[model samples]
Target: MDERDHASLPEGTHELSSEVSERVRSVISAAEAAANAVRHEAEQSAQVRGRIAEEEAIRIVDEAKGEADAYLAERRRRISELSDTVVERAEKIVARLDRAEEVRRQLQGLADSLGESAEELAAQLRDQPPPSVPQAAEAAPPVEQAAVAEPEAPEAPPGEEPPTGESEPPGGPEVVQLAEAPAEAGPAEAQAGDDRHEADEQLSARLVALQMAVAGGNRGDVEVHLRETFGIEDPVAILDDVFGPGTDAEKRVAWPRTGDSAA
Candidate 1:
């Protein structure tokens, strides 16, 4: 071979090298594209998972909030109902006590009147004289005694006895009828108490409903409930007595009793 030929590359070597280089670049580009696609797919999957997790978290939060709201609402309802029941019972007790006081006053007046009447009757009895007893009539004189024969019953034979069939009645033994016992007063009083208890229960139920209405803070509902529960048409009347005429507003207000001095 010549020196130039020796120095030059073999036939088709450059072309082959170029073709191999192209094939290698194509393989590298394809691999790079596959890796990019895989990375993109991973990113997308991660985004989807993150979104699902966020949604799940939001759903859990919403559920918890709903449960909490329901619990709070139920708690408020129970508290309001309990408060109304207590107030109703207290008012009823106060009313009954007032009635008892009035009854006591009435009894005291009646006793006083009875005492005065008894005193007048006693004075009249003392002023009148006792009546005298009547005298007995004179006794008659006794007559002379005379002898009289005595009659005797006939005796029975030794082997026979007197017959008692004619002396005995034909019917059965006599039965005595007893009168019925008087009805007790206790049953009437118990019936009255039962009626009162049922009325109290009804009033308590109405009062609880009224309290729920008041909790809603509607002015019309408050007025209606107040009138139905307490027989007070004006809602302002409940608070109007706090500072009445001749009362000091600056004084202490948490008194133990109605007549207690706030100061």
Candidate 2:
């Protein structure tokens, strides 16, 4: 064969050149294998990071669920406690109302008994005779004497005339006797005095009633009735001072029995 035909043929190449080409191809294959190893390592790293992030997300969701459950439990407990307190308060109020009703019934019964007793006593007293007119007239002499003694001058004193020489002493300090004129008590004043006297008599009668009640061993009940009937501010003190603690001398001085004319 010719040289050109042999050079184009696969069996006509140089043996040394073929060996060099094979060595160069082996170096290139090794470099390509190293690049493939680096790419696989990067892929493995990304997969590890994704797994870690998924685990962290799951843990966070679990923690949030636990916190929500705890909040709900606490709110339920508070609501239960408040409901129990309200029920207890309602029970206490009902109990108090029951006690108050009982007390009111007892007080009403006591007042009714006292009223019946007082009515019976008053009826019995009304059946008895009052003081005689002669006795009442006999009781008036001492009061008349007291009224006469209380006046500044005697009822029948004589009038004296002024002397002519009494005016000559005016240059010196004049002696002017300033005596208060007697009040002209018209029908209105007389009516007021009569009302005052009637009030005093009624008060005296009530004082006697209170004394009788105390002697019969019912002072507290009598005092309650007195307060209810008369609307008194201090029934006990008034009763004690008027009926029990007052002396005869103090009564005679403080509430002197005057004549009707003085009244």
Candidate 3:
């Protein structure tokens, strides 16, 4: 069982073992190559999947952004339109108010003219003469009593007719002389005439003003500055002041109040 047993082993056993070992090594190399190829394919597939997912995410985000931008743009447009509408309406209202203010100023000017005319008329009347007889009689009551006592006058010479008077005494001065001789008589008469002429002129002027107002026609708002500045609230009353209350000019002008103005 020593050297002879070893020498007695088959002669091809070593060669067979070497051939089997080479075949196993070749199989292992092929298997390793197949596994590497599969790994490389798996890595490529994972990379491709990642790239596709990134592209899809980018597309979705871009679409969402586009929709949001469109929505924002539409909202901005609507807001702009609303703002324009509001501005237009406000401008129109402002224009109307300006026109009303102008009208009010004009009406107030007319009222001032009327007030001036009234003042002038009042001054002229105040300057006119009062009766002279009533003042003299108070101081000359004795003369009045004498005139009453001597109702019958003594006859003058045949050539001269006696001056007979109803209210005067025989010794008293003539009433006509006292009437004309007063210092204020001349100025009072002149003032009365002047006042009458001025009143006529004022009437004519007021008529003209009323005609102009009627011709122009009242605006819708019909505000008068007199209402604010002078506290004359009624449009009709303003017209009355301008045209003279209850006069033909006032009736012809027919100035309307707020409700009638709208009509």
Candidate 4:
């Protein structure tokens, strides 16, 4: 081989080397591009996961808030229902008390009528006519010689009982005036009048005391006391017909109105 041929590269060797170097550089650049694509895909996946987590957290918070609101609303509804029930019961109690008080007033009116009737009856009895007596027979001689004659007896008063068998004096019976009978009775009539007046005063005092005891208190409490004090089976029966009607005298001792009683 000539010196020039030895110094120079073989036929196509340089071209082959140049081709191999170029192919290696192309492979390195392709690998670097693939790595960059993989990194970009990872970044995209991370961003998508972060967004999903944020959405989930927001949804959980919204759900929790919604549940809390519902719970609060339920509690408020229950409270409102309970309040309404309490108010209804209270109103019923008050209505019952008002009705009881009204009944008590009616009873008091009836008691008044009874007192007046009793007074009128007493006055009628006082004005009645006196009873008639039997006239005496003529004076008898000796018991064995003369026959005993019986005198006819007069009719008795409507209210008075007839006397038993008894003989009158020889003179006819003297009729005394009804007005003068009390004078003849003397101290007895005066004492009887005084006793009746005292009884009336005592009765009036008892009624006044009972009225004061029941005043301003609850109707149920007053009714209970009335039943116990009056020996009544039913307190409300004071207004019934069994006790008779009220009179002007009893009506004057009526209970005051609720508002007036407090004052």
The C-alpha TM-scores of every prediction are: 0.38, 0.36, 0.40, 0.36
For residue 108, give model 3's deviation from the true position in Å: 4.6
Every candidate's lDDT? 0.52, 0.55, 0.60, 0.56
Clashing pairs in 2: none
CA shift at 202, candidate 3, in angstroms? Answer: 21
Q: Write the per-residue lDDT of candidate 1 for residues 33-95, one digit (tens) a residue.
A: 999999999999999999999999999999999999999999999999999998998788677
Model 3 Cα lDDT, one tens digit per residue, 1-263: 47686577677975776799999999999999999999999999999999999999999999999999999999999999999999998788676666666776677577666656754654554565543332433445555665577656567889986675664553456643454355435567667776776555445444434434544533222224323432334445445565455554224444334334333
Angstrom error of the Cα, residue 152, model 3: value is: 9.8
Q: Where in model 4 is the C-alpha error above 4 Å?
A: 1-31, 103-205, 215-263
Winning candidate number (TM-score): 3
Q: 1 or 2: which has the higher TM-score?
A: 1
Find the candidate with the highest lDDT and give its number. 3
| Model 1 RMSD, rounded to 1 decimal | 26.9
Between candidates 1 and 2, name the one with more favorable lDDT. Answer: 2
Deviation (Å) of 147 in candidate 1: 36
- What are the per-residue Cα lDDT tens digits for candidate 2 across 161-198? 54445544442221111111112324455567656644
Ranking by lDDT: 3, 4, 2, 1
**lDDT score for residue 145 of model 1:** 13
- Separate clash counts for every candidate: 0, 0, 0, 5
